[model samples]
Target: MIGLVMAGGKGTRMDAKEEKLLLQYKKPVVIHVIDALKSSNCFSKIMAATSDNSPNTQSLLQNNGIETIKTKGDGYVSDLNAALSYLHELTLVVSGDLPLLDGGIIKDLVASYDGGAWQSFLVTKKFLDDMNMMLEFSVNHDNKECYYTGISIVDPKKISSTNTIKETYRIIDDKRLALNLNTKRDYDLLKGA
Candidate 1:
């Protein structure tokens, strides 16, 4: 299994000059999520996918020994395509700004798979009802158009271009999927706790 990280967003919501993924919260932004994923022990190949806009970001992640896939564009989708184009195997995709995420949550997701195209699986706190908030983004890498998450055990065979990729599809029933630190307010809310 491979782990694909999308780290190319400009993080416009974050008012600070620093990028959201680079922001430090006890540790750096990406590190916390990376560390959690590392702890999951589910992925054999772990790497980050970034673009040219953030040159130092690659070096920073590389310094920690994580392999980097540098590409040529913006948009998480662009970085997603760059990473997925090469990885034929199933991959667990994570965004750069997730810090409060837990690796065990992902492990549980993989375990829940019954071998279908489980584009979404995992333990997400139910805020409203039966609708599960797929928080994590798993790239249906085989096809650039397919993407799903909140923790998922992917069957690459089932991922096809027929599936829709939403830019910011929210789940009112379970808002827990997006614990994104995209703004100073988000950062403060997390750090304050």
Candidate 2:
């Protein structure tokens, strides 16, 4: 499976002068995501999905010898679709802003795929509340609200045949999977940890 990092979002919620992926906690946030993917040893190839909105992010990864692909920067779904179409294989997609995510969690997610076309890693609202993370969005799952961890395994062969795709929503209770760096508050929380 190819490892794809989505790094092209504008990150308007971060309200920072620099791209969110370039912001440093210990090192550039996106690098942490990339390193975690590498440590998982899950992909034959790993690439960052970049865009015009994040030229600096694209340059940093490229300069460091990481593979990158430019997308339309229109929106998450569109950019993701563009990347999946180009990859044309089974892929593990992760948000570049998840600085705290680690390889073990990734490996567990991969192990749980069960041959589904897509498997989304999610966190329950209770987990978000316990972490004091803001609830940006959620969906009803087994009578509980679940938040997307921005991590998933996708089969690119099924990209055009959405109607026939089988999806699994795996709810993880780990804080590492819950901390998505979207806002200043989220960054501050990560820094304080």
lDDT of each: 0.61, 0.88
Provide backbone clash counts, one per model. 4, 0
- Candidate 2, clashing residue pairs? none
Per-residue alpha-carbon lDDT of model 2 for 1-193, expressed as tens digits? 9999999999999999999999998899999999899899988998989999999999999997789888999988789888887887889999999989888988888888867789888899998898898646688788889999899999887766656667779888888888899999999999987
- Superposed Cα deviation of residue 102, candidate 2 (Å): 1.3
176 in model 2: Cα distance from truth in Å?
Answer: 1.1
How far in Å is the alpha carbon of 46 misplaced in model 2?
A: 0.6
Index of the highest-TM-score prediction: 2
What's the TM-score of each model vs. the native? Answer: 0.73, 0.96
List candidate 2 stretches off by more than 4 Å.
161-164
TM-score of 1: 0.73
